[model samples]
Target: MPPLNDDAIVLRTSDFSETSMVVTFFTRESGKITCLAKGARRLKNPFDTAFDAMNVCRILYYPKSGDVLQLVTEAKLTERFRVDSTVAIYAGFHVVQLLNHFTENFSPQTALFDLTKIILNDILSLNPICRSASLEDPPEKLSRCLLHYELRLLQLVGVAPSLRECVECGEKIEVRRGARRAAFGMREGGVLCPRCRPGKTRVVSLSPEALGALQLLASPEERFWKRLQLSQKTLGEIRGVWNQYLAHQMERPVPIFQWLKR
Candidate 1:
C-alpha cells in the first residue's frame, strides 16, 4: 500500500507489548482511524511527542487492504495543547473522549474536526480571560461553553434532538409556569405535546425562555457563538437536556461527565 499523509488529532493510545503502541487518531481526510505505532513507546521513539491525546500532528500511514487497523509510518506533532490550564486540560480530555467513543470510524466527519479545534482553541484562550475575571465567573463560563460544545457535537454526529414541534404528534408545544406545558420524550427524540406524552415518558420540564434558548442553540449557523446568551437557570436546563439525550443515544453513561461534576 502507498503511504498516505494527513493531518490528525490523537484521540487515544494504549501500550502494545513492550515497545509498540496502539493509537487512535481523528484524521482530516479519513475520519477516525486506529494505527499501530511500532516501537513508539521506546525512549528514542520518533513519535515520542506525537502520540499524546489532543496533540495535532501530520501523519503518514500505510494500510493493508481490508485490514481494520493501519500501520503508522511517521507522525510529527503540529500542535500540542498546553497543559498549564487545568480547565483546558479537562475540556480537551472531554473532546478527545467524545471523538473517540461517540464518532464512528472512517465516517468523513470534517465538521467534527473543525468544531473540536475551535472549541479547544476557545478553551485555551478562556484561561487567561478567566484569570482576570472574578473568581466565580470561570466555572460558569467553562460550563456554558462546554454545554454549547456538547450540543454542537451531538448535532455533528447526527443525534441532535428535534426541538421544533412534537416529536410524537405534529402539534406545536406551548410553555407555561416556567415549564414546558409539554414534555420532552428522550425515546421520541424531541418535545412531545401534553396529549402525546405517555404516562411513562421520561421528560425534563423546561421554561418557555429555556425552550427558546435551546431552539437558538440548535440552529446551525456560522456565527452561533455571537448569538448565544443564556442565563444560569437556562444553561442548567440545557445541560440537563443534553445529559439525558446523550445518555439515551449512547445507551451508557459517559465517565467524563462524572469528572465534570467534580
Candidate 2:
C-alpha cells in the first residue's frame, strides 16, 4: 500500500543483519508495530542511535498487506527523554514496558499514546516539581506516576479494575466512612464486598485509605497528582493490589514493575 508516516516511541530494537535492525515502536497514530530498518546500523545518515527506547521519532515505512512485518524507510529523531531523576528514569522504563505489553498491534490507541508521551516528558524534565511529582520522595512520586499510568492503560484497554463496586456482585463498595475492610480479588479484578468475598487466598486486603487514593488517582480530574494525599502505606497497598490484578489479567507478572520494586 502507501507509506506510513507517524510519530512513535521506540519500545525495542534488535540487530537484524549487518546493516539493518528490527524495531518495535509504539506509534502515535498506528499503535504498536514491528518493522525492519534497512541500513539503520550505518552512521552515514545518522539513524544508528535514534532507535533507543523512550526516544520519540517521526518514521516512514511501507506496509505489507497481511501479517508480515513492514519495511521502515526512514526515521528522524523528534524528542529524547532526558531523565532527571532515578525515579523518573525507572518510571519511564516502566511506562514503556506497560505500553508494549498492553497495546494491541495496529490498533488506534490515541489515549494510551498521549498518556505515555505526557509522562515521558514529565519524567525526563526531573523537575522535583514536575506535575507528576507531589511527594518529597522523588522515587515515590515517580512510582505513583507509574501506578497512575497502569490504571489509565487498563481503562483504555477496557479491563480496568472495578474500584467503585464488587466485581462479583456489581454492588457499590461501601467502606463505612473510615473502615479498612475492602478486599480486592486479583481474579475478580476489583474490590469485593465482605458479603461477596468467599475466602482470603489470592486476594489483597485493600484498606479504605488505599481505596480512596485509588479512586482519586483514577478519577477524571486528569491532574491526579494534585488530588493525592496518599501515605506511604496506602501507596504500597495500592501498588501491590493493582500489580496483582494486572498480572492476573496479563497471565504474567510485569517484569519492569517487579524490577522497580527491587
Model 2 earns a TM-score of: 0.89
lDDT of 1 by residue, 50-156 (tens): 88888899999996656477999899988887756555676778888877877877777888888777777777777765454432334655766676677788888
User: How would you encode candidate 2's per-residue C-alpha lDDT over 105-224 as one tens digit per residue?
Assistant: 898898888888887876775556444442344456556666777777889889898999888888888655677678888777788887888875688787777787788777645676
**Clash list (residue pairs), candidate 2:** none
Candidate 1 regions exceeding 4 Å error are: 129-138, 174-181, 259-262
Worst 10 residues of 2 by lDDT: 129-138
Clash count list over all predictions: 0, 0
Best by TM-score: 2
Model 1 residue 85 CA deviation (Å) reads 2.6
